[model samples]
Target: MRIARLGPRGAEVPVVLHDDRAHDLRGIAPDVDGAFLGGGGLDRVRDALAAGDLPELEGADALRIGAPIARPGAVYCIGMNYAAHAAESGSAPPERLVMFMKSPNTVQGPDDDVEIPRGSVKTDWEVELGVVIGTRTSYLRSPEDAWAHIAGYVVADDLSERDWQLAESGGQWSKGKSAPGFCPTGPWLVTPDEIDARAVRLRSRVNGDPRQDSSTADLVFGIDRILYELSQVLVLDPGDLVLTGTPEGVALSGRFPYLAAGDVVELEIDGLGRQRHRFVAHEDAPEVAGA
Candidate 1:
C-alpha cells in the first residue's frame, strides 16, 4: 500500500492509494501520525480498500503533498554514512556513526521550493533515504531487531549550507542543517512489506545534470545497524523520521557541482516515488526581522 497525505500544506487529509486511484477517508479513524501502520491499522484499511469501503478523493490532481508522517517527534540524520561521500570531503570513515538532528519544523511537502536563508551563499542539497519508524524502541543487540521498528521508507532531500557547517562559529553540523524548510520528503510512503530495499538504486539531479549517483548497497552503515545503534541512546518513537544518509555525489563530496539560485532539484528512488524542488537565492526572499 502507498500511503500519502494530500491537499494543502497545513490541511492535508490522510488517504491511501490503490489501483492508481486516490481514496478519501475523511472521518474513518486512521490517522497518518500513528495507527496507520500499527495495531492492525494497515490491515483494516487494506481490507476496507479491497472491499471498496473507501471513496475516491475529491481533488487528487491539485493537492499538495505533506511529509507522509504527520507529527514526527524528531528528525535524526546520519552523517558521512556513505564511503565515497566521506572521501569526497577528505575524511576517513568514522569508527562509529555520526548522528545529528534537523528540527521537525524544517519538514515540508516534497515539491516545496527551498528558501535560501538570508545572508547565505553556500546552500546545497543531499538526496537521502528516509526511514519512518512504526513503533517505539530502545537498545537492541542485533540488526534483525532493527527491521522490526521501521514502518516504511520515503525519499528525502536533506538541503544544507557549507559555510555554516564548517567555516562559521560551528559547534555541531546541525547548525547548517536546521534552517527553515530544509527537509523535503514524501510524495508517498512505501511500506517495507511492499518493496525490496537491500539493493535499491538512488539518484539525485541538480537542474538537468546528475550530481549524486550511488546505490544503497554502498552504504557504510546499513539500515539494520543504524537503527540498532541509534536505539541504544535514544528511544525511537512512532512517526519519528530517520534519514538513512545520502550517498556520494554531494557538493561536500567535491566531485559534483554545487547548487545555485534557480536550479531545480530532483530525487528518485525505485518504488518509493520521485520528488522535485527548486533552489532560490537568499536575497530573493522578503525582508524580515534579520534582514
Candidate 2:
C-alpha cells in the first residue's frame, strides 16, 4: 500500500492509496508518527482496507501533500555511500561509513519551494532512497536484521550548499545541509514488501536537465550494511528517517552548475515515488539572536 499525508503543512492527515485513490486513515490512526508506526498501525490499515472500512479521500489529487511521515524523531544521512558519488567528489570509497544530520525542521512537502540561503552560491541537489524506520533498532546482530526493522521508503532530495558545508563553516557538511526546505521528501511512503529496497533506480533532474541517474545497486555501503553499522552507534527510534546517500552526477561533481532561484528539481526512486520542488531565494528572512 502507498501511504500518504495530505492537506496543509501542519494540519495534514494520513491516508492509504489503493486503485489509484486515497482512502482516509485518520479514523484508524493518527498522523503517521512514531506512535502510529510502532503500534502496528500499518497492520490495522491493511485490515481495515480488507474489510472495506475506509472512506475514499475526496479530491486527494488536488490536496497538498505533506511529507508521508510526520516529523520523525530525526533525519540521519549517509554520506558518499555510493561509490560513484564518492569518486566524483574526489574521495576514495570510505573505509568506514560517513554520516551527518539535517535538522528536523528541514522536513518539507515533496513539492514545496526550496529557499536559496542568503549570500549563497553552490546550492545543489542529491536524489537518494530514504529509509523510514518502523521499530526501535540498536546494535543489530547482523545485516539480515534490517528488513524486520524497516517500515517503508520514500524519495528524498538532499539539498546542500557547498560553500558553507566545505569552506565557511569549518568542515561540517550539516552546516550547509540543514537549511529550511532542504530535505523535501515523499509524495508517498511505500511499504518494504512493495519494492526491493537495495536495488531501486534513483534519479534527479534540475530544471528539466538530468543531473544524477544511477541505481542503488551501485551503493558502496548497501542499506543493510548501513543499518548494521549505524545501529551500533545510535538508537534509531520509530519513525526516524535515514537518507541512504545518492549516486553520482550531482552538481558537486563540477559537471553542472549549482541550483539557482527558480530552478525546479525533480527526484524519483522507482516504486517509491517522485518529488519536485522549485527553488526560490530568501532575501529578507528575519534574523534570530546569535544566528
Candidate 3:
C-alpha cells in the first residue's frame, strides 16, 4: 500500500494512494506519524482500503504533497554506502558503517523549494533510498530480523554543503547536512510488501541535466545489514528515517558544478516516487518571524 500526506505545509492530511486515486485517511488516523504507524495504522489502512470505506480525497491533485510521513523522531544517514560514491568522494569503502544524523526539522515536502545557504558554495544533491522504521528496534540478532521492523520506504534527497561538511567542520558532517529543507522526501511511503527495496534504480537531474544515476543493488552495505548494524548502536523508534546513502555522480566529486540559485533538481526512485525542487538563494527566501 502507498500512503501520503497532502495539503499545506503544517496542515497536511493523511491519505492512501491506490489505483492512481487519493483516498482520505483522516478516518483511520490523525496524521502519518509514530503514534499512527506504531499503533497498527498500516493494518487499519489496509482494512479500510479493502472494505472501500475510505473516501476519495476531493481535489487531492491540487493539494501540496507533504513528506509521506510526518517529521520523524530522528533522521539517520549512511555515508558512502555505495562503493563508487565512496571512490568519487576520494575515500575507500569502509569496513564499518559511517553514519550521521540530520536534524528532524530539516525534513520537508518532496517538491518544496530548497534554499542555498547564505555565504555558501558547493551545495550538492544526493538521491537515496529512505527506510522508515515501523517499530521500536534495538539489538537485533541478525539482518533477517530487520524485515519485521520496517514500515515502508521513500525517496530521499540528502542535500549537502561541502564547505561546512569538510572544510569548516572539526570532523563531523551534520553541520553541512542539517540546513532547513535539506532533506526533501516522498510523494508516497510505500509499504514493504508493495516494493522490493533491495534492488531499485535511483537517479537525479539538475536543471534538466542528468547527474547521479545508479541502483540500490550497488550499495556496499544493504538495508538488512544497515538496519542490523544500526540497531546495535542506537535505538530506532517507530517513524525514524534512515537514508541508505546515495550513488556516485554528485557535484562533490568535481565532475559538475555546485548548485546555484534557480537550479531545479529532480530525483526519482523506481516504485517510490519522484521529487523536484527549485533552488533559491538564501537571501531571496521569505524571512520567518524569529528566524
Query: After superposing candidate 2, which stretches have Cα over 4 Å from the reference?
Result: 284-291
lDDT of 3 at 214: 89
Worst 10 residues of 1 by lDDT: 282-291
Q: Between 2 and 3, whose lDDT is larger?
A: 3
lDDT of prediction 1? 0.81
Compose the digit string of candidate 1's lDDT tens values, residues 81-153.
8888888778898779899998888888788777788777778888899998888879888889988888889
| Pairs that clash in candidate 3 | none
- On a 0 to 1 TM-score scale, where does candidate 2 land against the true structure? 0.96
Alpha-carbon local distance difference test for all models: 0.81, 0.88, 0.93
lDDT of 3: 0.93
Best by lDDT: 3
Clashes of each: 0, 0, 0
Candidate 2 lDDT over 10-34, as tens digits, reads 8887999999889999999879988
- Model 3 over residues 1-291: C-alpha lDDT tens digits? 999999988889999999989999999898999999999999999999999999999999999899998989999999999999999999999799999999898889899888899988999999999999999999999999999999999999999999999999889999999988899999899999999999999999999999999899999999999999999999999999999999999999999999999999999999998999999999886542110
